[model samples]
Target: MHVLRKAILAAACTAGLAAATTPALAQTTLRAVMHSDLKILDPIWTTAYIVRNHGYMIYDTLLAQDEKGVVQPQMVEKYETAPDNKSYTFTLRDGLLWHDGQPVTSEDCIASIKRWAIKDSLGQKMMTFVDSIAAVDAKTFTIKLKEPTGLVLLGLSKPSSNVPFMMPKRVAETDPNKQIKDFTGSGPFVFARDEWKPGDKTVYVKFDKYKPRPEPPSGLAGGKVAKLDRVEWRAISDAQQALNALSKGEIDFVEQPSHDLLGTLKKDPNVDIVASPMLKAQYVFRPNTLHKPFDNPKIRQALWYAFNQEDFLMATVGDENYIQPCKALFICDTPLATTKGMDALLTSNAKKAQELLKDAGYDGTPVVLMHSTDLKALTNLAPVAKSLMEKAGFKVDMQSMDWQTLVARRAKKDPPDAGGWNAFLTAWVTADVMNPVSTAYVNAACDKASFGWPCDAQLEKLRDDFARETDPAKQKAIAEAVQLRVIEYTPEIPLGEYVQPAAMRKNVKGFVIAPVPVFWNMEITK
Candidate 1:
C-alpha cells in the first residue's frame, strides 16, 4: 500500500497536479434546489452572469475573471488593446475544438456578438454601445466600441454570452427565440439532453467526446478547464429533503440549511459547516410620482416610517445576519451605498408614520401589497404594515404570487396599478447593478417603470451619467447626491438585504453558494 501510494504521489508531482487535479466524481452526486428552474439555457435573454458563469464550466470566454479578480486570458492566445482603448485585437489560439470535434473559431465568437447586438430579437440592453465587431479571420477578431465606457472588459468578461462566448453568427441569428437545445459548443462539455423528471431531478452529463482546452485559446482568458467527466445538477427544493439526502449519503453537499438544524448537523463527525451568510440585497418598490400615492415624494417618505426593516428581515427570512437597515436603493457593499447617512437618521416610528399619512390626507383606502413566492419568508413581513397604515387612516391588503409571475408583473408599466396591486416586495441582485443609479432604475417604484410612479429624474440622469462619465471625483459626487435623493424621494422602501439558503448533507464538497447560481469550478468528491 505504501509503495502504491508513493507511485501515485510521484505521478502527481511529475504532472504538476495534486490528487486534486483529477479527483474522482463523488460517490454521492452534487444536488441542489432552487425556488425556480433557471429555465432559459439561452444566455442572451437575461444578463445572467450566474447562468453564463455556469456556462464557463462548459463554454469559454476571451477574458475570464480569476479567483483573485484579475482578468486573465482564457481563449485569446495574444491580444493588444488599441492606443485609444476603444478597439481590441485578439488572436485566437490554435487547435481548440468543440465537443463535436469542430475547430473553435473567431467566426463562432463574432457570430455570437452580432446576434447579441444588432439582432433585436435578443431583447436585452447590453451591447448597446458597440459600434461593431470585425472577424479578422478564423483566428482573429477586432472589436470596436461606440463609447469609452469603464468596466467594458468587465462587461465583456462577464459570464453571460451577452458579454462573451460568441456563437457562430450563422447559428445564433437564426430565429433568436428558437430553442437550440442540441447544445454544440467549444467547451469541456457538449449539450446533453436536459432531462427533468416531473418531481425528481435534472441532470446534465458530460460529452465523452469533448477535448481538453488548448494550452492557450482565443476568447478564453485562460480559465480553469473542466476537471470532471460529468456534472449533474439535481433540483431538490425542500431544504430538509435535500439535507436528508446529504445526511443519508445520497448526495455530496448542501449549503446553509436552517439555523435550527445547525447544532444537530454539527454533531456529525463527517460534517463540515461554514456559517456563511449569503451576499444579497433585500429592498422594496412602490408607486411613485408616476402613480397616485407615490406621486407625492412625502408619501414615499411616509411609508419609510411605516416599515420596520430591522425586524422585517429577522422575522421574515429568520436571518438576523442581514443587519443592515439600508433604506437606500443600494446595498451597503455597493460603491454607491448610501453615504449621506439618511438611513442612520430615519426611525421606524408608527406614530411618525401615522402623522405623515394624515399629512398626506390619506383616506384609509385599501392599499394592495404585492409579493412573490417568498410567502414562507414573508411571515415576518405582511402583517407589520396593517395597523401602521390603518392608524395612518389607510386600509391595506397583502397580495402574493410566484416569483416568476411577480417579475413578469413588474415589467409592464404600472403593474401594481394595471394589475390592481398597490405595493410590491422584491429584491435587486448585485450584478451589473452595482451602483445607485442602476439600482434605482430597476427597483425604485418612483420610476414610471412601476406604472407612472414618477421616479427621481435627477437620480436617473445621475445613473446615466455615472455609466458614461470618465471622471472619478465627478462620479462620486453624483453617487452621493443620488443616495440622498433615494432617501428623501423614495420610489420604494429599502428593507433588508437577504440571501436564499439551501440544505446540504454535511459531507458535500465544493459548494460555493452565491446569490446567483454558482455551479462552476466546483464538484463533489468523496
Candidate 2:
C-alpha cells in the first residue's frame, strides 16, 4: 500500500510540474477526487453516497429541496395539491430531453416513482396511501391518494437515499432489485458511459441540450447551470495522496479530505475548504437482527450503553469542533429531535451493559462486524466498536472490506459464518434522517425493512402513525415515542454527528452549498 501511494504521489508531482508550465486547456474541466470510487450507478438500487452523487450528475428530479429545506419544482413546471389533499397534479417543463434526445414525459416520471417505491422505506409507506400515479397527458401526471395524505410533496422531493431521480420509461421499468443498464437522463450533465472505468475514473460532459430554470440555483433545486464543459471523477483512495494532488494542482477538488489532514489543507493558500451548509450528518451503527447475540433486544440495548458516542466520534472525526454527541434517531436540532430515552443509553455504563448481556444469554459467539477500510471517515469506526463490544464481554469478528463491498454484503441474509454480518457503522446526511417520513433506518418492517432488517411491530405502528398524523405537536410526540421505542428495541446505535468538509482549488467557483456535493454551477479556472 505504501509503495503504491508513493508511485501515485510521484506521478501527481510530475503532473503538477507539467501543469505549472503548460497553459490552461481550451475547454474548462474540473478534475475531482470524490469520497469513493463510483461502483454503483443506479441510485434507486442503493443509498450509497457515491451512487447518489453520480445520480445528481446524470439525472433530474421532479422536485428538489433548497438551502432552506423548501421543496421546489425541478422537472415539474407547476404542481397543485387538492384542497382535501387526496390528489396532486404535476406538469412537466418544456425542453426537457433525455441525453439520447428522447423527450421527457409524465409516463417516465410515473414509472421511475413506481420502481423507486419497491425498495425505498418512505416510498413504500407513501405508496400505501397513494391510490394511483397516472399520466393525464404527455406533459402531466397526477397522484391520486386513497385518503388524505400530507407527505406527498415531501416524499417526492426527498433529498437523499432513494432520491426520486427521473429516468427514461424503459430504464425506470427495470427490476427494482436489479441495476439499470440505461444511462439516459435529462439533467445538466450527460454521463460519459464509455469513459467510465469503475475503480479508476468516471467522466461527464455538459448537456448542451439542457435548458436551465429561470430561478437561481439553490441547494439541489432551481437552475442547474453547468459552468464547466467537462467533469472528471478520479478515484484516489489514499487521503494523503489526494491532498498532495490537490495541493499540486493535479486535481481541482477533493470531495472529502481526511479530518486529521484538514489542518494541513487549510494552511495551503491555494486550497479552499468548505462545509455543507446543511445540518451535520449522523453516524449509525446497525446490527443484524436475524443473526445471533444481536437478535436479542437486551443484547442490542446493552451495546447502546457499552459503545460510548464520544469514543466513536473522536476516532472517526478527530475534531471536536465539527462534531456533537447527538442521541436522537431524528438528527439533533431537527423538529423531531428528542432525548426521551437516551439518558441511560448515552451514559456509557459498561457495568450495566455487561449485566444486560449476561441476562440476555449472550452465548459468547463472535460478532461478525463488517468494516469498510477504504473510506477515511469509516476506517476507524470498526476498531472503536470492537473495543467497546469486547469491554462489554462479547467476542467480535472484525471483517474488513471496501465501502462498496460492505454495502453489497450488508444486504445478504445468510448467517455470519455464511457471509452475513452482525453490525456495521455508516453515516447519513442529517436531512435523510431528520424525520421518520424520510428515515429508512427507523422502519421496523420485518423482511422489508432497511439493511439490518430489525423487526418490531410496535415500532412499525408508531412510524405508521407518525406518517399519517397531521398535527405537528402530535407528530413530535409520536417521534419522541418512536425514539424511546428505538432505544428499548435497539435496532441501531446513533454514534453522534459530524460535519464533512470538501477541499477544492481556489479557482473552482460556484460550487453548490447543498448537502449533496453537486458539480453543477461550478467552474474551473487556471
Per-model TM-score on C-alpha atoms = 0.73, 0.94
How does model 1 fare in lDDT? 0.53
CA-only RMSD, every prediction:
8.1, 7.0
Best model number under TM-score: 2
Clashes of each: 40, 0
- Looking at candidate 2, the ten consecutive residues that score lowest on lDDT are 17-26
Q: How far out, in Å, is residue 261 in model 1?
A: 3.3
lDDT of 2: 0.85
